[model samples]
Target: MNRAERPPATLTELLSRHDCDQALLAALRERRLPELHFYQSGPSVRAWTELCSSSAYRGYARSFALVDAHAQTIASALPDRPIEVVSLGAGDGAKDLRLLRALASTGRRPRYTAIDASYPLLAGACAAAIESGYPARGIRADLLRDAHCREAGRMLDRQRARLCLLLGGNIGAWDPGDTLRLLRRLTEDQDYLLIDAHQFSERDTLPQYDNPTNRRFALAPLRALGLDDSAGDVHFRLGTSATVPGLALVEKCFEFVETSTVSVGGARFAFRRGDSIRMSSSGKFQGHAFALFLESAGFRIRHQFGGQAGGQVLLLAQRRGAGG
Candidate 1:
């Protein structure tokens, strides 16, 4: 791509063009629950990086096994040409690099682009790829915004083909309708979208979110925003997705036990007792429900990798009407 037309090459430029910094600053200035997504801040990004890398997290290493096992299959499904590997919400780029390595094992070396709003995480991703001698770049763009999505498209359009990764159930955090809309924005015909989701079940769902590691990961931004555990407690509850029946959701909430005040960006907001702020929610999908969702969103599933044990899953899908 021409330098003039290319998406912002650095975090500073991306932040300036997208006003992500300004929006978060404004949210903090107004003392409202930050409209910022969970991965927008440095501390939260670090917390997530740690959580994902920690040995205590199940499949911290095993998650890459799926990529290794399906490497050749994924490579075969793509157009028999050089491709760009674009990872959305790529925290630390751990799983992405594994996928890239697997592709390389299949005799394809793809240029990697890590798309995320967190500058710290984005820099780390690019740095790791470069250190490993892979051609790579980082775009600090918020995935939820349409403008950023367009910028990502421009970055990928320069390649012969594109493989998009939405690993670790990243899409599950949004409302089902918004998730489909986001997917639509992020992909074009013949492009590949690899997304993962936790299998949903009535049992063994809530415990995943109720743990300390997750509480810390989910509350990192709150603490960085200057709220302490004393001000509120982080909790999780199970809910059902109204738009997608049979889809389960884990809602992360911060509920204040007593009246308190939080100050950020020189602004202060008072919270009444018993008030709650929703931090984030993740969707859990049954295998059939996930396939139905992809089909509904105009994607044809090319391959579904991972065991059927009702946990993490990776689905490789192509925009309909094309073989790639």
Candidate 2:
């Protein structure tokens, strides 16, 4: 039997076993304590909503186009099977929805599964899927961990032929080498994977960390903790790093340089300037390097789409067969 036919664990079970919230909180605190407080305060939902809905963020649309093309390719490969399109970090499912809608137009009804760690985002995606009359379900799991991958693999095991989607620079944000290995383990011979590969050009400048919009977004949770931006020296800085041989990771760090009163979950604290608060990193990849990484992970590149807005590449890879 294919792995997609196995019974999988529930989202609740995965979350409890992983203890993601605690891990996230600890990671944030150790790296940048203020950011942890801000995240737990919960204004990121609105920020993410705004980010996805804004005209400035057209990356989703481009991603949607690539997904559509990928769906067509997968459909051609497994013409008679129920397509299982599993999206990791699905966000609002806006891009995936576009692909599903396109597939429906081609008379191919896909079983849509969205995997995400954010409950709010998953809920929103489910609602949207319901409204669209699509056969869709959501699994709330952190794609960054192995157990989550195992659970996802079990879920996929229940389906026919599978088509996996990982977009929105999600792979780039995490460790690509590790992510690719995990992905390889989850994918079997019957699956086709579609992952977004972002190209970094010298002309692409980093966004300002403390822009008015960004500051407002970051301040929402802080205010809930009775800490205003004015109550602290909130400094935001932009920097870039490399996660792999050819991938560039660029991100912004929002720090509380100084604060009079800082309280989180009822605990109170005070801090001086020069203290780092919170940081969020976004990733960009070199196309050639991304292709090489995928090949190394045992995927045979079937097709590649390039020349989109913000310089993106879509890789359609199939698992390698035995012996050959």
Candidate 3:
């Protein structure tokens, strides 16, 4: 309650649980192995850098605006109480910093906490927050686990009111139904959520991924693992399933065709043509279905906004009261 001095030490420490390390390790291994191999060769950093710096990467800005508006709403809802802002997947804290700066103009000093899985990004956020004169702290935790949610709940329990943000279409990047339930479990009473939802669209989604710029972004991390575009064939595809009405699911899968043998950590590894790696992140609900998902999440929508891409939705919702 007295302002955390630093972010949680490790994913396990933050969650306050220990059983899932093996499962988590496996997931991370699957996700990072290619990147790690590419990093060994030193060309992947460029892709990762470009991916984070491009205009498309700044999508969180829209969410930040919605959050600022939501903050104003919360200020009106709890006229005399202090508000605490917690951001899940708070990448680099740039967007949140904008809101904090605006809050400062209003003469309201809010306590801020940013939780992220990336240490480098968390460090950047910490530095930015400090420079901006915010009493901010960062927590490194994986939100997919229950223990982390419980810890987050404990942190929010102390605030008079809390605003939790899950930005960058992070919800769509995973299973929305389960993710929403996990989000609800982490939220304490009196907390609000400002989340970005992808509007479902029938247009060609592959071009976005296939774009040279976007492809560079995707492969940068892979290149870091010593895998080049020529090293493997990258494939993109969509998953058609009806989880909710009006929502279309498209999944981008990257298959790296290894052309030669590589070594990592003093060990040798080999790859063949048929061997493929899959990196599937979902893009969902580009339009109307976006609204329905929020309603199903037990949130009473207060307002919504249209994004520049025409397929993204930003929603400001309040947790439904008991019996609502």
Candidate 4:
């Protein structure tokens, strides 16, 4: 298909195939929702929006010099040409607008493509971009799957430089190796991956993830299938990966304070009073750990931005060629 005809799939059309109910039941078998469905529905989306907009999350970003990095340094580093900005798990797309505006200020014409599984969030991201006067497309696909990744990559306007954004600590939601393999399919030799990561701190991270607001967000998927927090309690604990040492994380687990049975789409799951299921794990890097983490993932760090105490980071990395 020609560039004009590609990405013809509207947000609604893409969302039609992304069945949250079916995904939820499949994920229940594992007693956990992968990052793909961890935050999957309208309620979940709204809850996450609330958490991100909360003073704690926003305040942390502000105190860490992230705003300046996004506006000036990060945008200034992009190639001076037409660019196609693609963001995965884009959420509300709030993090993208600043860099988009900064690119525009530099006399660069850039378009946007928001790839997310949530209909409400994806639509908002696309509408915001169009209202802001940038051409945009919304693709509802799970970035965790290889086929979905390549197909979404093809739907974009390939003539321009492809700059992919996995912002707002979304990559930390999944295993780093899995994320690296997923991103490699979405990018090519010259394409760029602009990613965000957070530093670990109980004092700093606890307030962000340990609150009731975040608990609601994490339990949203279960609530969609006739289960609620009343069936269990959400707990946050520091986690470490057996594979990667010195990696700190805030692991959210839902412990069944009362026995619960969930039935959805002709499938039923039973849980005992003492049974528990993992909700999600968000990774936090130590100082300079995120850079080395990305480098080891086969992405050569071209330019790095935003690394204050327990702050958010945006790194511009290029896919390393063979032996690079």
Candidate 5:
């Protein structure tokens, strides 16, 4: 259709003409920010960085360093061939560097790819790999989208074996079923999947998300919706899945103190005084439960590593019957 003779189009269609973010718009319509969206902008990235540095949340990252202790074992488990590392949700590329260094020590140079939805985070991940003198590149991808996942798979060098890294106990950040489907998409018959999960113990995890820095990060979406601190209260509580028995998650949400409504793009969305909207949640698998979960989801667990009194775990997995 000719531009002058076209029918009326919605703002989204117009925005599309200028390349606006479809995912952000879709989430904004719900007045909530899912975990992936939390890192898309610089402000959110800085907020996450602040939370990660705080005493409350910083300790969890130390657990990921366990990969260093298990690197040689991980290398020995893999096939004796060139391996390219693909890091999903590769924020800052810190953890992948540990794995890459392990591969490098095997008398071979390793290639790395950091895929993320955030340009700022993607740039940092790519830069870290380049600075370490390893060949690397960043692919801008929304991990939640199947098309994006398939596109990323296409970019890999097909001849070499692939070791997919989904570290930082990230398995908790997504729904268990969703996570399983995602892993299947990211791996192939000969590929390796390195994933980790933090156990949701009331003692260690509860206080971490309830602290000041994390509170700020959780309230950001509500604040953007034009709600002030006085408009509601923030709470961190543990939730469980009805279907999956061992599954548990710590949820961060904002409860409205009074009835309120918001207007965006001429759409009025209502909120009750007691209603709440989630900011984020991480699925915490207890002990060998994570390993069992992977097997149930059709992934074959090859090697397992952990520390912090069994509160954390890293599993090297592959598709069922994928072993050479």
Candidate 6:
């Protein structure tokens, strides 16, 4: 079928799609802590919202400025046809709105689709997008799963060009191999991929996770599991690795100060005093390391944008070929 013959994609075809409830219940039944559920709880979501507002998170502003400065170029990269702005882990949809507005200013009004594992977050994002006059949809599916990605992609009008977003240093916390795998799953030939990273060097402030707000955000998951401040203390540590040289790692470890028992799935697990569990970690790449990493993952970096602080880097990449 020719592009002209295809029916126009309507907002109804892309409205709120979710499977988070079943995924969360299954994760809980397995006695495992899923990061996806971390934002599902009220406290975690609030803590994350607060964390985003903190002064240290200047990456958002810097990235937005970069996108705005090059809005025309970015928009020109898209096909002349209809475009779909698909943001993974969209959070409150604020950043996506910024990008969408930038694209609009360049005479492009694309459909916006926010994909997140948390239904509440996705719903809020979709609502905000709709209020802002963008055709919007929300998909509550784990982006890491193959089936979910396939289903999410299938929702797009076949002829529409896709711009997949993975922003806010989200990829920094993921394992390198898994990160590559996710990029591969999310992009197809000619599809655009916008990803951000938090750069780290010896000169940059290294102890960001030491802040109380940072601690609260990272430990929010533990709180959702019924553990409180008294149950443990969250600490930050810096480490280096031989495998990925020039990449600095900041890890958050929650150390139990006393004996604690948490109940899950009608069973209890014991945590001895002084036990330390690594909660989350972010890798800060230096110089051209991030570019090389992307190349290694089979992506060709089309453009690079740096934030004001010189720490937040955004890469506009394209899949190498159809298989990618």
Q: How many residue pairs clash (N, CA or C atoms closer than 3 angstroms) in each of the candidate models, in the order given?
A: 0, 8, 18, 0, 2, 0
Instruction: Compose the digit string of candidate 2's lDDT tens values, residues 176-225.
Output: 66577667657777477877866666554244233455556566655665
lDDT of 4 by residue, 1-324 (tens): 345544432563444443656766777887876766655667777777677667656533542246455666767777889888888888778767776888888877888888988777888888787777777878887777777777876787878887888877776778877788778878887788888788776578768887777777788777877786679888888877666545687888888888888887778899889888887698888788888887877788988776765777778898887756
Q: Tell me, by lDDT, which candidate is best.
A: 4
Off by over 4 Å in 3: 1-25, 28-49, 52-80, 259-271, 307-309
The positional error of residue 40 in candidate 4, measured at the CA in angstroms, is 3.0
- For every model shown, what is its TM-score relative to the native structure? 0.87, 0.79, 0.78, 0.89, 0.85, 0.84
Q: After superposition, how far is residue 6 of candidate 4 from its true place, in Å?
A: 18
Clashing residue pairs for model 4: none
Clashing pairs in 1: none
Cα-based RMSD of candidate 6: 5.4
Task: Give per-residue CA lDDT, model 5, range 186-246, as digits (tens).
Answer: 7887578888778667678788777888888776645655667787888888888765667
Task: Report the lDDT tens digits of candidate 3 across residue range 1-324.
Answer: 223544332222362223233333354346433221221123443464565556654444445556555555544443245667688877667767766665555666666788865556666676677666677777766676677777766765364567677776777666666578668876654467777765554564545455666666566544544565687656667665567666555555555455555443344445666665555455666546676777777887766766434345677667786777
Candidate 1's residue-wise lDDT over 1-324, tens digit each? 344444333443355424754576555444334323567677777777677766545534445667667767777788767788888878788778777776776667778888877777778887776666567888877667777777676656565688988877776776667667667787778789888777875666677667788778878877876778888888888888888966888877788888877654565667777987765577888657887888788898988877364566778998886553
Q: What is candidate 1's local distance difference test score?
A: 0.72
Clashes of 2: 8
Q: Model 6 — which ten-residue stretch has the worst lDDT?
A: 8-17
Name the regions of candidate 4 deviating beyond 4 angstroms. 1-9, 12-19, 58-69
Question: Considering TM-score, where higher is better, how would the candidates rank from best to worst?
Answer: 4, 1, 5, 6, 2, 3
Identify the superior model by TM-score, candidate 2 or candidate 6. Answer: 6
Tell me the spans in candidate 2 whose CA falls farther than 4 Å from its real position. 1-13, 16-20, 32-42, 55-58, 68-74, 77-79, 208-227, 231-243, 260-271, 322-324
Whole-structure CA lDDT of model 3? 0.59
> Positional deviation of 182 in candidate 2, in angstroms?
3.4
